[model samples]
Target: MSAETASARLADIQSRIAQATKIAGRRADDVTLIAVSKTHDAAAIQPLIDAGQRVFGENRVQEAAAKWPALKTATHDIRLHLVGQLQSNKAADAVALFDAIHSVDRPSLVAALAKAMAESGKRPDCFIQVNIGNEPQKGGVAVAELPALLAEAQAAGLPIAGLMAVPPFEVDSAPYFALLAKLAREAGLDGLSIGMSDDFEVAVTIGATHVRVGTALFGARA
Candidate 1:
């Protein structure tokens, strides 16, 4: 996409966010817009940075690794968020790569990441992924099991920063988002990585600190 195209798209997204904030009686700053830049090329992200977007979300370790080298020279203050389930084998690379890891679920992954971060001299913030809707295919700890898992991770000295969830495939999902927000608040979590392109406004209305938007920003990915 041309810079002009990206500029226009960003303007539209900002307008949408402003409107959502107004309707919700919440400050726009309350919701952080994380542009999901997983499939897009490096050149495509420069325009977004030019438009004052500092945070971007990526889905895969290898894909993020491929793009980070180019992006590093392009912008100095950009923050990269890894918004995918991290395999234990990839924990070391994840430690070296992202500013925050949003999909930490199991105790094993937590232990591995803590060890990896310690060894790499990099301590990235992390979130416990909650399988809110309890879908078998989705990767997250069951909501009921969160407190225990978090306690275990904390015991292991894993630096957990917050909680993340992807709502069920075929549901309203607003209630689920609201539940996650409530749970996070009760747990005193500083981060809530919820929402996507389709329902980010609802996510914002219900109090999402970070909303991951992909197609709305980068357009449809093949």
Candidate 2:
């Protein structure tokens, strides 16, 4: 994508976010827009950076490792977030690479990340993901098991950021977003990392502090 194309896309998304926040009676600045840049190579990502998009989300630590070091070197302000399911074994790399992680779901992963943080001397803010719809294939702690998992994370000294979830696809996402917001509030978490391209405005209305938008910003995957 050209710089102009990226700028226009970013502007539109920002405007929509502002409008959504306004409708929700919330401040737009309170919401952070994380352009989900997963699968897109560096060539595809640079335009957005040139357009002043500083925060981005990526799926895999390995892919981000391949792309962001150079990007971050070029511009030191970029904030990278890991927005996909993370394996326990990849905890160390994730901790070292991401500024925030939106998929800290299991106790085993929590334990692994704690050890990684200790060993690497790098601590990344973490969001406990909840399978809000109880989707079997998704990677989130069951909502019912959330409090215990949160207690486990806290016990291991993890820097808990908030909660994240992906509502069932093709379904109305508002209820699930509302549920995630409620769960986050109940857990005393101020950050909510919910929403994607299709439902981010609704997500913002419901109380999403961070939105992981990919196709809406970067366009459909080729």
Candidate 3:
């Protein structure tokens, strides 16, 4: 996409976020918009960066390592987030690269991340991913097991930022968003990594602190 198109798309999303936040009586700045830039190469992502998007999300650690080192060196203050399921073995790489990791779902990964942080001295903010829909195929701590995982993560000394979830597809997401918010409140966490391109406005209204927007910002993936 061209720089102008990228700016326009980002502006439109920002405007929608503003409207949603206004309707919800929340400040627009309270919601951080993470442009999901997974799969798109540097050439494609540059336009969005030029449009003043500083925060981006990638799905894989390897892909992010491949692209983001150069991108981050070239640009200042760019925050990269890992918005995909992360393996325990990749904990060190993820810790070294991402400013935040939004997929902490299991105790083993928490232990690995804790070890990585101890060795590397880099503590990335972590959001425990909850399998809100309880889909077997999904990668998250089951809702019932959330407390255990959260307790374990806290015990490991990880920087627990908040919770993250992806609700079931083709469903009204408000209830799910509301439930996630409730869980966050109960856990005493303030950050919420819910919402995506399709329903971010709804997520915002329900108190999402971070919305992972992909197609809406980068256009449909190839």
Query: Alpha-carbon error at 73 in model 2, in Å?
Result: 0.1
Model 3, residue 147: distance off in Å is: 0.7
TM-score winner between candidates 1 and 3: 3
Tell me the RMSD of model 3 versus the true structure. 0.5
The global Cα lDDT (0 to 1) of model 1 is 0.87
Q: Per-residue error at 140 for model 1, in Å? A: 0.5
Off by over 4 Å in 3: none
Alpha carbon lDDT of each predicted model: 0.87, 0.94, 0.96
Q: TM-score each candidate.
A: 0.94, 0.99, 0.99
lDDT of 3 by residue, 1-222 (tens): 998999999999999999999999999999999999999999999999999999999999999999999999999799999999999999999999999999999999999999999999999999999999999999999999999999999999999999999999999999999999999999999999999999999999999999999999888999
Which has the better lDDT: candidate 1, or candidate 3?
A: 3
Name the better of 1 and 2 by TM-score: 2
lDDT of 1 by residue, 1-222 (tens): 777888898888878887888898988887778899998888888888888788899999999999886787678888889998889999999989888899989988988988897798888888899999999999999988999988888887777878899998778989999899889988888778888988888887887778899999988997
* Order of the predicted models by TM-score, top scorer first: 3, 2, 1
Clashing pairs in 1: none
